[model samples]
Target: MSALDTDRYHIFGVCTPKDYCLFVDYVIDEIKNHESSLLQRIQETPDPALRVWRESTALQGTDIFEIECVKDRETAQEAVEFWRAYFHSLGETIIEAGHLCDRLD
Candidate 1:
């Protein structure tokens, strides 16, 4: 099981390896063009209960992401929606979305 299974965080996002390189390149370019806007958004929120994370799996060429809110499910859902909108605004395609829950182990 992953650490997410043991943590108090709820995670969700989309993934795709089909256009991984293009996606990554676009992300880098977008960051360069919109770093200020991105930073401003985070600063504006500044929610102590919220955490955002990203991971790139080389073997799978998959980029997995999650918005972890150290709060209730409602808060988590809100955070996920916020990110979903942000990514969509950037023209990123979300192939899937879900949450990470504690394992039964």
Candidate 2:
């Protein structure tokens, strides 16, 4: 099993007419597809300096995913193309994003 636990869930919001079911479904699909790659990327890169928070914000009506992940200092630019493809396919907006590492402490 992955060293990570369920408690380390990706926390994000999906607004779909306030319908819990739709929101849940969106989160579920996103978690399934992005979780593995994200975890792997996060793991392969050691220091917290390499962390990035992938975020998406769809407009009240339109369907777009605005994903912004912190650029790896070493890489020198946000991997927008990779993340954009993932989030765009889902029709969600990549609104706000940043980098973060899970700190037990």
Q: Cα lDDT of all candidates, in order?
A: 0.37, 0.33
The number of the candidate with the highest TM-score is 1
List CA RMSD, all candidates.
Answer: 14.9, 12.8
lDDT of 1 by residue, 36-95 (tens): 443343334334322221323222212333344344445555666676677777887643
Model 1 residue runs over 4 Å out of place are 1-7, 20-62, 96-105
Clashing pairs in 1: none
- For 8-59, candidate 2 gives per-residue lDDT tens digits of 3333333334321112111212333455443453335444332222122222
How does candidate 1 fare on TM-score? 0.39
Backbone clashes counted, model 2: 13
The deviation in Å at residue 12 for candidate 1 is 3.6
